[model samples]
Target: MAFGLVRIALECDKEEENKGVRVLLEELVWRTYCNGKKSGFATRRECEPKE
Candidate 1:
């Protein structure tokens, strides 16, 4: 992900990767991210849920 995007995502307390998926769903809408992707390095699976 781009540095700017990462910054924005982190500021929103969003998890970078799969976990970010949930945050996007809660904070942003479908258009917030890719058509079917999340934010962060490693695949979406890299970042797991807190609990």
Candidate 2:
């Protein structure tokens, strides 16, 4: 039963990966994080250097 649940979770993750859902999720996380920050400086994520 636990293995079945893990398989389902992985399948759902694969589908979302192909649909670029991670980018959307990251955008939401970045926005929420920036909004919660106390600094007034720049907070845009696109300007961040790719590591």
- What is the clash count for each candidate, in the order shown? 0, 0
- Report lDDT (CA) for all predictions: 0.39, 0.32
Please give the range of 10 consecutive residues that has the lowest summed lDDT in model 1.
4-13
Query: What's the CA error at residue 4 for candidate 2, in Å?
Result: 39
Give the alpha carbon lDDT tens digit for every residue of 1-51 in model 1. Answer: 535332222224456785435634354322223433555432233355874
- Assess every candidate by TM-score: 0.17, 0.14
On a 0 to 1 TM-score scale, where does candidate 1 land against the true structure?
0.17
**In model 1, which regions exceed 4 Å deviation?**
1-11, 18-20, 23-25, 28-51
Looking at model 1, the pairs that clash are none
